[model samples]
Target: MNKATLASALGSPSAFGQSQFAFMRGNAFEARVKADGGAELLRLVHERLDPEAPPPKGGAVPDLGASGPEGRTARTALALREATGTGGWTLLDHPLLALDVAGSPAFLEPDAVVVHPDGSWTVVEIKSFPMLDGSADAAKVGAAARQSAVYVLALEQVAAHVDPAPRVRHTVLLVCPKDFSNLPTASAVDVRKQRSVTRRQLERLTRIEEIADSLPEGTCFAPDLPPDRLTAAVESVPATYAPECLSACELAFHCRDRARAQDAVTSLGRSLRAELGGLTTVGSVLAAARGESGDPDDPAVAALRRAAALRSEALGGVAAPRAAAEAVPCP
Candidate 1:
């Protein structure tokens, strides 16, 4: 079931809604960049990624409209083939590409893609963030790079079917507002490392069919189901909840409540959870730290005990349950 729908059923809808002003700003920036048949976009791509090639006079902006995602993907492929054969610059605006993810196909529509004169392809990512003094926020840039990597991976799948497969450039063009102005600026972000890591991670995911088969028989997660039934259905499937899920998963808040109730160490974050080792709950970790339980030979338990003792000594031997609780990692 869709996590967003399940989250709504549980009365804890996702808190990741985009701001209206930010959304409008982003749309405006994208429109400006793609204006005049993508004249500015082509200039940025040429200046940042293909300076040596003849300055782009104009490029074909093909009509990729179709019935559905599948039809659009097919049209994109055909357009790519034709563009490569003609050996000219072409801009594929919002082209849909498919990538197999966990035994299912995920269709992704990137902002734009440029076919170079040399038959190479470049992914373009446009953002509203300002490029101040020739640079933008590093964190935002890194996030864009990772996102572009996914598009690059999808493009590679499409390229494989082409007769003379075109090279999908690892360095993508990132277009953003120029120094507080609406004018666009571009940067070439190398995403080879991000692409490799994303591909490996996607490959490691367990198939959806395997996970569904493991669920209880007759389990249903329809949004209209009773709250109790929907909750049970969702809980029947195990999940590893981490703080990072807040930004990515619609069910993050629901999972966080359950994790906190169970004193699951993962509620704090993955790093702290890893450090706690076998002590997967706050209560157990505290007991082991107080030397009231747990094997002394266990390194994690020993470290916790030592840290607790040091904290007590620093407090001049006063019983500090509150302090201990405060020091404990939890949501």
Candidate 2:
């Protein structure tokens, strides 16, 4: 069963939901950006990333029609190979690329991928956020960059199989509304660091088959099962929960409840959990802070003790204020 269904069965459905208005607005913005054979989008790419190349003129918008994801992925690969040998601009809209993730194939459809005149490819990300004074929210930009990096990685996989592999640029084009207006603006964001990090993290994931083999016999996650049985089945699979999971995972609430019940330090944040070293529980952290336990030679324990001492001294030195009349001098 999917995490959402499991969560609903456990009476802990996800709290995060997108508003209809925001959804509609995003769709409209993307349409405008990709309208007219992606003329405006192509122009932006030429202006920002490939200024020395000739301006794009009615670039080829190949027909990527196919029945299913598999068909579409094959069609997209064919179109990309055909476009690579040419010497003109080509915009591939919603191309499906297959990436091998942890010994499994995962399909990804990027907003668009542009084939440059020099046979280089650039990923494009369209967002509804407003870019004020040529700048958008840093957090949103970072998120978009990370997402685009995944697409780049997928594109690279396709490139590797080609006779003459095309270069997938590390920089992606981000399109957004300009200064609270509907007018589109573009920016070039370098995602080399994000790509490297994502590639490393994905490489580190354990194969799904190995994880499944380790599970107990007959450990089913069917939502129709009784609540206790379903919960037990879920708990059988160990999970590393962090605060960021609330946004990305459907079972985050259930995991959060479990973490809090166990006084797990990860319920606070991943960074704090990493900094705490061997202290995996909030009780251990508190005990260390109070000087009741933990080795003094440990850096985490030593820092906690120093902070506790400073807090106590600050609280002890706090003096009571005088009466208002006494301070005012009868003025």
Candidate 3:
């Protein structure tokens, strides 16, 4: 069975799963865009990303099909090398590329990889999000840019294998529906910053060997393990919980529950944690606000005390100190 099935069996929410409605909609939109041999897709890339470059003239979509991800990745690398030598427009649909992340290969599949006439490649990311009045949601666009950055990083690995390494453009093409219509519109998003950040983070990640060494001997993460044993095994490993994990991690809810149970101030949010100084727990922060136990000289504690006093005064000065402390917002 796949990882998702194992996760479901283990009572862990599927992080990679999406709603059927959204999944179907996105798939249909992408299929429509890529119909007609991706003619519209090429036009958008030419018009939006590289207008100066000649329009994709009779591009070829080489068949790079293979049974598994590894074989497909190899085929994609071979196609890229050939495309570079030809110096002609070539579009690779759903091509697989692999990047070494934390000493492991992370395979990525971009919507399309367009090999330009200049031997440079562009990563294309297609989304169903509409561009209303030439403006799309900034947050969604940012997410697409980050995703494209990952594809770019993976492409660079392939480029390294080619003689006279071809360039992987930092600017990617983001294609979306135009103004609530199914017609495609494209925008060039520069992902230099995102690419650098992702590269650095991936490079700096702790190796799996170190983590395994730290775990107790005979520990296993098999999904079929009993609930109690699984919970204990999970708890044995350390986790750095933050608000961002909610959208990205399957175990985020579990970690948040643990944090809340332990009174960790970080359970609320990272921003709140930063302002709490030495007060790392919700209970400690509340105690400091109530002036029960904290270094009065610390700016964070002093500010909390001042804010608590002002809040009490605003409430007609009738609120008891403990009650006023409890009313202080942790957000």
TM-score pick, better of 1 and 2: 1
TM-score of each: 0.95, 0.92, 0.93
Q: Point out where model 1 deviates above 4 Å.
A: 315-319, 325-331
What are the clashing pairs of model 3?
Answer: none
lDDT of each: 0.89, 0.89, 0.85
Per residue, candidate 2 scores C-alpha lDDT tens digits across 1-331 of 4788789989999877769999999989999988999999999999999999889998999999999989999999999999996899999998999998889888999999999999999999999999999999999999999999999999999899898899999999999999988989999999999999999999999998887899999999999999999999899888988999998899999999999999998998988888889989987887777678899999888777776665556558342221111111010
Task: Give the per-residue lDDT of model 3 (tens digit) for 101-216.
Answer: 87878889999999888889999999999999888999999999999999999999889888899999999999899997888888899999999999999989988788889999
Q: Give the lowest summed-lDDT range of ten residues in model 1.
A: 322-331
RMSD of each: 2.1, 6.5, 2.2
**lDDT of the structure predicted as candidate 3:** 0.85
Whole-structure CA lDDT of model 1: 0.89
Q: Put the candidates in lDDT order, highest first.
A: 1, 2, 3
